[model samples]
Target: MVIKMRLGKTNLEVNKNGFGALPIQRRNMDDSVEILLHAYENGIDFYDTAHFYTDSEAKLGKAFEDVRENIYLASKGAAEEVDEFWKQLETSLKSMKTDYLDLYQFHNISFCPKGDDDLYKAMLEAKEEGLIKHIGITTHKITFAHEAIESGLYETLQYPFSYLSGKQEINLVNKCKEFDVGFIAMKAMGGGLITNSKASYAYMNQFDNVLPIWGIQKLEELNEFLSYDENTILNDELKKAITKDKKELGEDFCRGCGYCMPCPQDINISMCARMSLWIRRFPAEPYLTEEYLEIMENTNECIECYACVDNCPYELDIPRLLKENYEDYQNVLDGKTKV
Candidate 1:
């Protein structure tokens, strides 16, 4: 049987687990389409994409045309102004090959509540114009998410939710249920920190209102989630393994929210976190070269304003972690230890 769940306050039904199209954007068009088609054939009906994700809208548009009526398509726009918002909506419609989007979200509203209102009004206008079926918003900030739900201007709220989020974020899940707002979970795998797929699936399965969109690029990862629908349960041994992994991952640090982006210094905070894992855990000798050291050290330019730290879902010490990572990266560059 297909695993299905009800999106809050709407008649729409979707797969309890959905496919996130971010990672697949890194792959070639043919490969991405194949993976998306595989996900659809295996009972995934909810597809989340954004105009920001390079070529993701176009790929999903082409792959799902035959099955479009049977699926739910959610897309987001990063537009802040009225004209830009309208332009993005039009671009998304063209890219997705659909006249009406199942859900249209304001992407990553960090602090500007007033701006959110403007966007909400535009979405309402769009809905009136028959361009969107429902309105939604996505955010890395828990405070903004709470506000979105409380404002009742949105039908859904997408946020960074993984085993790594703190109590405040965990409570947001409950609040979504209380407010009858659909909770679409992003970064369910901790952006690759949660290596165990079974653990990730089991943790997400505990939430009834939340629908996790796993960024599946390969058939293997897609098949893994598909297996869960077929009755694959996490055993005692697997539970123990997950616990150990969580402990090692530590607590309260960088939810990979991508808030501190487009740094003036060109430092990639999100990729640095991922590469730090490679420098510490995996065989990343090649990445530890002088060129890579320059990239790691570039984070020193972070003015210590704690902008990223404050915006992080897990409330990580952004500057400190960046500095610590720099040191580790230096050691690896010097050949003191295997990266």
Candidate 2:
């Protein structure tokens, strides 16, 4: 079965399931190379990595030098300055063992890169120099993604998208299609919040123009997606599963974007705010340990200063959500509820 699509306005045709290279950081170099090779052999040819992701690009470089021309390599840089931008681009090119990238994105920034800025100028010069084929941007904020699409400055917009996404996110995907901007769906599994792979795959299958980058670290996870045929469609069961997840997860759930960090209480707001989801979606043991309990305990120290709430781009009432999750977590510790 052939599952291929054109990424936005880019000429590169790749499988709908792009390999998100973030999770590969957990594995050794040899293991990461093995998984990359296996994914390539099994039909995934689009790879996304970032300068922030430690050694992910280097690992892909090791595995992809031979298949250089055959795959679409996309990478991100966290540079806001002119010099930092060039350094990132050069380092990415050197580490990937390639002279050019299929797409180079501004990673998780609040503002859109404009041609007038030195950073954007760097991208233009890089494209002119054949260092990057197209320019793109990735962000956790929906409004920013929409703004990028409307700006028409980018060839693609990578954003967090999944079955748990609501009407706003769906509209963002539509905007990308309308603007001819490539829509790269990140966190398709909801940052490991979605436990059902088949359901996630089927849900994403509904969007023809959207390309989901599944973070592949394990061969077992890679095989699960590869096992599906090109014509994989959502049926009553899958539809029901997706609907159930959307309903249960709701719009209020923590996405783990970590924008609400550096809490005055020193709480890991990213983890504690979504503690309920963690226990429900993943193994209960890891988060239930004493170490995690202490992390949850820190939630009690929140000064209610609303710092996180003010900073959240999603406009989420983070303090209220954190308090609720902390209560639920404490209940679980008290044996009042089963995870």
Candidate 3:
């Protein structure tokens, strides 16, 4: 009943359910190790992390240091310079306690790296040195993702994909299949907006080529995905949920991908832009914390530079969105708005 798929030319037969290690950084090392070991003892074999995810790789290293060969370890680096790229590579290798990575990806790139690019050269060198088995790139932009696949410089593509995906996103998946490029799906739950796990699982099941990495923080979340390993079906009820989600999510809302990050004003644009929805959908108490109040107040300092807008793959008017969410957030704080 175990669901496994081959990851394109890399030929990594990984479990359909990949362990996304981003959320584990929030937990203490002991808790993180327990959850990771629980996942490994279950059925997960593909573990994905990134250099930016603080201590996530080290936690995996501690948990699976002795069993490194049994699982596929993939991590990403966001370095731009050649030397920095090497440093990131060495840090990941030492942290994960592995000599070679099953897959090494250029993380969340905005442009398709060309052969002449130094970062691309570094990736080639790493593979040549047997430091990384295969080269891949992750991006949120659809055009650049297509460019990466057509360029034939990468073996895998990790992008935001979920049941809420529109036709263009689905076409990208088909294109990866056509080019024999592996597709690694991130944000499979619409960044915590899609509450229906069965719907997400069923939608991903329709794709034979995708490997969806569910960001697991709690054992309950891990157990939900592991339960889907057997007897998953695209039933009418799940299909109805998918249809409802797509209709409601539309195309303009933020998926909280963090691609529009590091605002010049230090505004939490990623979460602030979607504060209106989060305050309503989730519990309101956490959003009203003193730390969050400061973060939201920083939205006033936006310079209208549009740097975030340019980086955003979805092309959202992030400054404008932040203003709207901030106003609503203020109203909520003043008790004028009902939760």
Best by TM-score: 2
How well does model 3 score by local distance difference test? 0.91
Window of ten residues with lowest summed lDDT in model 1? 109-118
Q: RMSD in angstroms, all models?
A: 2.5, 1.4, 1.8
* lDDT values, one for every candidate: 0.80, 0.88, 0.91
Write the residue-wise lDDT of candidate 1 on 33-131 in tens digits.
Answer: 999998888889999999899899999999998878999999999987888999999999999899989999989855534434776678788999989
Model 3, runs deviating above 4 Å: 289-294, 333-337
Candidate with top lDDT is 3
Q: Which of the two, 1 or 3, has more TM-score?
A: 3
lDDT of 3 by residue, 231-251 (tens): 687888888878877786677
Residue 182 in candidate 2, Cα distance off native in Å:
0.8
Ranking by lDDT: 3, 2, 1
Which ten contiguous residues of candidate 3 have the minimum total lDDT?
Answer: 242-251
Clashes of each: 0, 0, 0
Decide which is better by lDDT, 2 or 3: 3
lDDT of 2 by residue, 81-156 (tens): 8899999989999999999999999998757887677888889999999999999999987777877888789999
TM-score of 3: 0.94
The candidate, 1 or 2, that scores higher on lDDT is 2
- TM-scores for all candidates: the values are 0.90, 0.96, 0.94
Q: Name the weakest run of 10 consecutive residues (lDDT summed) in model 2.
A: 226-235
- How many pairs of residues collide in model 1? 0
